[model samples]
Target: MVRLDRITTRGGDAGETSLGEGSRVRKDTARIEAIGAVDEANAALGLLRAQIAAAGADAEADAMLARIQNDLFDLGADLCVPGAEATDARTGRTRLRVSDAQSARLEAEIAAMNAALPPLASFVLPGGSLAAAQAHVARAVVRRAERRAVRLAAEETVNPAVIRYLNRLSDHLFVLARRLNRNGAGEALWVPGGARQG
Candidate 1:
């Protein structure tokens, strides 16, 4: 329901961006870094989703990607909040926070997916079908985002759910990659030297 055209105020041309609290800071600040990493993960997912669509696969993956995109927006809102709420008096939008239930949902999904995948015996190189390989790339980015959020949490008040979500998301991506690789035409490759260990 938000209008798009009138929102960009051109106030950030000087290397500063506005937070939810109306205060401006350098674009490279910890808050921005966390948000940026999330955005990157979202974009990567989008790319993989598009490839899936092109392949005429089932709609499940696309549907999930759409949901994840929405969650990323929520995460950005949570990150942009100055403290716990917005500063603008006209709009009563509050700061973003992740709930325990959301984190639990991700954990549940990871557990279900990991249950189906075989145990890893050694470090594996990341590549597979185009979509699956892209998923792996997104997984790596999600891990980086998790680390960045952890650092941010150390310095400021970040929602713990964000960290939990990132951790689970990386695991989700790994499973998705393997599943996609199992699809027709996918050629999943493992590290040539990898051997299962008892």
Candidate 2:
């Protein structure tokens, strides 16, 4: 088992940090922002998972969220490593690249979830259950992260998979918010005096 306390070493106090592959870089590096964004998104998802678990939702959703948490960790690793190549501790080989297959999977998940949701006629107000609201917040943060990654791409070689991942993840979170609102018995709030169906 991994000890939680061993993760932080205060190595970033001087505005310098180490990547997952053991290369030291500045804290404000594009790679670092990309990784940090994934971390923030993962934490937001954790909050949603905890809310769902506490509300006694089905085990399947909770299980999915757990898998997402792990995937985000891998994503962070991918972003942190330079040139998308890192020596794998377990395999003793350079393991990198996020893979087109992973991006496809996220797309598939988003499609599946959106299929069950009602068609949207108006802009959504991002609030309902605590979980739904937080999911929306996560979605927005992921968009910001995507922008940062794009900026980095302009100056460096970034894995295209990272871009695709963020795009799909935002879609996933949007659908997730709808799902949580439905499942948690929270009503979707329309804006006051908003236009109705034509």
Per-candidate clash tally: 0, 0
For model 1, name the residue pairs that clash.
none
Measured by C-alpha RMSD in angstroms, how accurate is candidate 2? 3.9
> How many Å off is the CA of 38 in candidate 1?
0.8
TM-scores of the models, in the given order?
Answer: 0.83, 0.83
Best by lDDT: 2
Q: Give the Cα-based TM-score of candidate 1 against the true structure.
A: 0.83
- Model 2: runs farther than 4 Å from truth? 1-10, 85-92, 183-198
Best by TM-score: 2
Q: On residues 1-198, what C-alpha lDDT tens digit does candidate 1 reach at each position? A: 546787678887899998866788999888899989999998998898999999888487678768777777787777777443334345765445766676676667667656766666654457767788888999999998898888888888887778888887888888777767764235445656458543
lDDT of 2 by residue, 16-132 (tens): 988766889988888788788888889888888888888887576677678778877777777877665446665688766677777787778778777877777666788898778
